[model samples]
Target: MITFPKDFLWGAATSAPQTEGAALLDGKSPSTWDKWFEMEPELFFDGVGPNDTSNVYVQYKEDIALMKKMSMNSYRTSIAWTRLLPDGKTLNPKAVAFYRDYFEEMIKQGIEPIINLFHFDMPWWLMEKGGWEARESVDHFAFYAKTAFEQFGDIVKKWATFNEPLVHIECGYMGDAHYPKVHDFKRAIQVGYHTLLAHAAAVKAYKESSQNDGEIGIILNLSPVYAKSEEPADQEARHKADLIYIRSFVDTVVHGYFPQEFIDLLEENQLLPETQAGDRTIFEENTVDFLGVNYYQPLRVQAVENPRFPAQSPGDFARYYDWPEKRINPHRGWEIYPEGMYDIAMRLKKDYYNIPWYVSENGMGVEGEEQFLDAQGVIQDDYRIAFLEDHLAMLAKAMQEGSQCFGYHMWTFVDCWSWLNAYKNRYGFYRLNREQNYARSDKASSYWMKQVIEQSGFEYGGHL
Candidate 1:
């Protein structure tokens, strides 16, 4: 008979680049994705690109109705910066009108819209002008955030300045998942620093302005790191991974400063990001009102003496290895450790001042989902049901133990195009049948989710 508070939020989350398909329509300019797909379409899986998404631009009304039918009390999605500002400065009137109508309709349907300003869809013009590496780019992002707030402030009350800034830093700067890929360690640190500065500036703008009276936050994809063995070297590697991957942004946003050990390591290695005098003060005064955590898996790390990269990357400290007894999602090849969710809740309560937060993104993505469809066209996703049930059980236990978690938002509402993976992995309540003009059909999980939301919790062993 476990139950959640009556006010607990149940929602679904999506992003602009993954869902919105009208890439160049309505005065929308070229994002890095549009340009990247133009240049290197081969890099994208199955040659599918950004503009081939689920067509939310044309189907948003139907989608919102689906969300309402599914009993979603709230919805989270981002505004494409490219769509809003064609040249990085001016606000397109059409873009403004579209978002206003979009938010209003959700509100009318009894669903709260939580809008994120940036979701890694960096404007191509900005990328050409040095992107997050150039200090001035921070100001440009702040301007975008300000414009979004002023325009949509009347309709949308909850705002997120950025979604997974760490992904923007790691995947874009240090790996190949995002555009303008470079592997310079110092530049990676700079991108992280400038991104945080942009976040701080946006937080400050939201608080100072009288345009919107909503809470502002950032979404982070955080994971708990575990050492491979109980050795001194392995422990050191785990600590290093924690600092680089977790503490860098979390500490700055919550505690208003970088971890001293993190700074010391960067300084010792000459990889510290260049910063101005007033940046510290900005972070100090403009901490966020809440946090949105996107957890998928925990990290497993061991000390690296020989290291994979040429000592220039963060690889010198740690290297990843598979945990022996790990249960994996065969389709996505990602670890599925539900207990990590409990560890995350307790860590936040113990270390991060018990800040108000939520499971902003969590879901199971399976490949080749059509084979599971029953005669009624519902994808019988018992795996997804079990995956969510186990995680939600952990969440319930954590809440009972006094975590400040306020909500749980599934990864998405509909099957949409992933960044580089394209439609290789589908994580959605409704399966999108692209052959039928992106027509969505219910998966078994959708009805199950509605029951969970209606009951405010699910039973241990029951039909739902």
Candidate 2:
């Protein structure tokens, strides 16, 4: 029998914009997502946009009761900035009262609330002002952080300043994958720097303020990069990939400074952004008390003599290459190697002073729900169970090796709105029925996860 430590945190994660459906209610202003859905609904999959989400804003009480049924001791959720401060200036009393009630209800149900301040839901007003790329936006974020801390700090203890800052930089600025898409390396670097600064500023505000018992941190989606082969070129490519994807933000948050290699890369390519005199001090002075790691997949890279682009020349930029064929995950597009999670944890333990950390997000995304359903309206998601079991085994091995991993929280509890994919990829333990009263049904994986949460660990059960 594999038994976890007594203090293990077993919970599920949900972001406000993804789960909350009352997008326009309670004096809520338009967030970037709200605006994007209105202007370009074509970007969404199956014509299902952000406004029509899980409706958890109004159904949270029922959801909490479901969580109790799953025996979840903790729950992770984000606070929509627009919902809290409609105009991004004045605080919305209704919003505050609603969240306060929510938090108090969770506590009353014996569930710990892990509140995240931002989860890719930027207010449209701020985005119009250049978002994280502008220095003024960082000040606005700090103000928002202070406002949230002062208002909800009495009940909420675990605070995550930002969720997946690297994703925002890479997807929104460097690549055209996410909303407000632009392909400018220099702007990406600037946005990345300002994001780190914003996180540090939020941490500083949380620490200096009257919230003494609250623990503050940031959520990072750490995708461990691997080389296709043992060749020197492949190894070099792996290092570059790691620097670009993982270390740039990890070093800044963990060590309170940017990685010198990253700075050198930016400087060499003439892609370095303008930095103020006191920016370094702000970053160095305020480091997080903990870390939230969202591990989905690994990245496989290979060296390239001259990276190719569709355009002739997009100015000086740091470029590496991807070898998609060398790595594979047939089930999902992402590369699935459970060992990567172990390597990430061990590396963090060795290099980053073994900071207190937890698996904030890890799960499988299936294309459809038919594979898991029976004729009697029950869904048996055995594949998801196997996927999670493999990852949990890796996490357990890491824990045995002295990695200070506090707990594991899956990608979500119920099917929620995925940004651009809309509902293309479902990653939930509970199957949500869009047709029938937004009714939720427990999958086989959900039952398995409940047992795992009760046991806190897994034993050898080969393909059970």
TM-score of each: 0.98, 0.95
- The residue pairs in collision within model 2 are none
Best by lDDT: 1
Residue 92, candidate 1: C-alpha displacement in angstroms: 0.5
| Cα deviation of 365, candidate 1, in Å | 1.0
Q: Write the per-residue lDDT of candidate 1 for residues 1-464, one digit (tens) a residue.
A: 65788888899999988998989999999899999999999999999889889999989999999999998899999999999899988989999988888899999999999999999998989998899999998889888888888888888888998999988888888888898888888899999999999999999988877775889989998899999999999999999999999999899898899999999888888888898999899999989889999999999999997864334787798999789899898878899988899999999999999999999999999989888999999999999888899889888999999999999999879998988999888899999988798999999999999999999988866322
Model 1 residue 10 distance off true place after TM-score fit, in angstroms: 0.6
For 196-281, candidate 2 gives per-residue lDDT tens digits of 88899999899888975879889999988877788887787778777878888889898988889978866766778788989888
Candidate 1 residue 251 Cα shift, in angstroms, is 0.4
Model 1 lDDT, full chain set: 0.90
Pick out the ten consecutive residues of candidate 1 with the lowest summed lDDT: 305-314
TM-score of 1: 0.98
**Off by more than 4 A, model 1:** 307-310, 462-464
The true-versus-predicted C-alpha distance at residue 325 of model 2, in Å, is 9.1
| Worst-scoring 10-residue span by lDDT in model 2 | 310-319
